[model samples]
Target: MARLLYELCGIEDALRFSPFCWRIRYALAHKGLEAETRPWRFTEKEALAFARHDKVPVLVDGDEVVTDSYNIMRYLDHHYPEAPLLGEGMAETRARFFNHYAERTLAPAILRIIMKDLLCAIHPADRAYFRRNREKRLGCTLEAFHAPAQGLDQLNAALEPLRGQLKTSPFLDGQAPAGADYLLFGHFMWARCASNADLLAESDPVHDWHARMLDLHGGLGRNARRIRDVGAV
Candidate 1:
């Protein structure tokens, strides 16, 4: 078995935090694949490295630079076919759906809140720096995120389906914490901190599902570092 070298850009707060990166970590752990995790920090130089050098959650299998969560999962599936990340059929499809849904739909809400409310609330001197870094990672105009309102409601709504899903399976894909579970871990990373800080809280299937996922995987890694001591999910 080839032990993979995983490079992650660690950010504990805000939307830029690497929940997506965490998904890859969780998948590596779940697959029982031997690997080393190197936690990287934020800096313009670091951001430039990932962007210019193909960005992160960059999985190094020997010399190959494998990036993107779904793409990495696919690579893993192809190579390590034993404990498959995607199960047989319908289950695998569901995991894929959840992964895409989280990236496409759920992520923007938390991002919007972080961008408009949180970032702007920082000192005026720091906001420009913050916006510049965010735009680099997201490849979008900071002005677009000036209104996080649109992203907020949609995030909550997208999360509604998960509440019902969690009621049935401990993991998003079913009995095992498959690829979707890892993806969800990343998606929920930002909001987890907010509830803890008492800035705001979320309700329902979202909370419950988070509980189950956290219980299974320990906790979402993105916000886990901020724990005064430790956090469950």
Candidate 2:
């Protein structure tokens, strides 16, 4: 059987927007491996019951089932060692840090800016579930929680460390893209695919790096369908 990847999508099946799923998608491309991607949505918990995970991305690799984006990356590297992604020694440790940073800091910041737009993009069947769950976690309604102006400021400030790193190198992992690159790139991809929010300024080095990432692995990110034009960086 072919490797199957369950990924989160929006209203249209083609609109694969989840940051975690994007990480695995890029990881698979980096390994030069292909998997048939299956679109999953917020209300489709039953579809993923076999994986025993509430969230994506779920990777079905023969008899091995992998959940979580970071684990999926590790699994790919372990199984396909020809092109190492997590790097070696201290580099691996740094990638781990990037993974955490993406989940904790970057994802939240972007979500604040694009949550409203995201709601519009997701499947109609998922809106209620998405809103209920998100509002409960956020302690406010989606409209009250979304603050693009504040979100933009927070996002830029939170990106200072990454901005400093990009000043010296083109990618998070020095000259070439790696796990660290994908970790953060997935967040940006989240905003790109779901919202028209202009998250990055043209002068920002991070914007340039994002463009580079989109062009990587045969334009895997660049070619993906988005809800609307995210506007120029």
Candidate 3:
């Protein structure tokens, strides 16, 4: 029985841009674990029927099946406790807050900045599905949704809390990188892979933390295939 992870990819199989999936990718690396990743497109919901979920970041570990990024993180930490991700007590609670912050605050800001580029980066077959669903949810077309200038401002504002925290410590989770670090890092990876826009200024502490994150786990995020690498951007 092999460990398998189904993650979302773009036009090219190597161009994985989903922030949720990236969280699991970093989590697996942090645990010193490896799983064969299968590239899944937006329109390939049927492929995940076995997991009873229509989303990426679905992990199949031996006889166990886990859906959703946060659940997968907890599953990995429980199964492989050697390198714990979600710490005990308050630490774990804080990590969960980071997860929500990434999903609710950070992700939307980044999406607003990169929606157009992301649309172009996704597979042609998924374009219609992506645009339709996103427009309905956002109540605006992709073109109208893209506001890099405003988005960047919103992104920076949303990151102020993290920036203040990082000012005192090197990583989000104190001395070492933990689940909280990965939670936020995933959103930045989404922006990096999908668009060429510069979301962070060089002087920001969050930007410095992001650089350190990219170099983690043998440069997993840094070496990931970007849209530009596939000539999508």
Candidate 4:
């Protein structure tokens, strides 16, 4: 059996905002890597505890600790060569690229739409602490994100070629959902958190496919105790 000591992450991240971590978690789940998740909330110092390079996605495999989301995904791909994250043909290749682009570029737009100022109405403490900290670290105030994000046009343009693929195929890669699905899933999930639940709720096949990914994984996500338990930490 593959050991359950796979990866670790932060909790409030999904809401507090960290697209990178969410991408890694979904990658792990999609591959069925059965890793232990250690969730660390970053209201303060916890974010740095496992960061080898001062980041959140610190993958702990037994005594080994790997940081960097891309590196983590690479490690999983290398270790579990079966059920490849990259699918088989040109279409699959395109889907993988689409996933990466959508996750990387379109993410900010989705976040801007989600984390809007309706915040003071709910989870004020968490919101306040996150804003203060991200500002200190990124060198900008939370208000920076308030400017009606400017990348959806780019996102829509990027996803244009695949708009047809998504409409025709049930999954991003057609019959089988590949690693790409999880990547995009993380984006949509984060959008939901940031409050743009309407994006996916719109007439997009991505929403239906995301629901299927959840079913394949057997739950909302790899919130395996190791990860979800960190909610309190």
Sort all candidates by lDDT, best to worst.
Answer: 3, 2, 1, 4
Q: Residue 138 in candidate 3 has what lDDT?
A: 89
Candidate 3 ranges with C-alpha deviation above 4 Å? none
Residue lDDT tens for model 1, 37-129: 654433334543643554556677765667777788878888878777766578767777777777778676667655543443333444566
On TM-score, the leading prediction is: 3
Worst 10 residues of 2 by lDDT: 224-233
| Model 1, global lDDT | 0.60
lDDT of 3: 0.90
**Model 2, span 24-87: residue lDDT tens:** 9999998999999999998889999998989999999999999989889888988998778896
| Candidate lDDT values, in order | 0.60, 0.89, 0.90, 0.56
- 201 in model 1: Cα distance from truth in Å? 6.0
Better of 1 and 3 by TM-score: 3
TM-score for each prediction? 0.68, 0.95, 0.97, 0.67
lDDT of 3 by residue, 9-88 (tens): 88888889999999999999999888999999989989999999999999999999999899999888889988888977
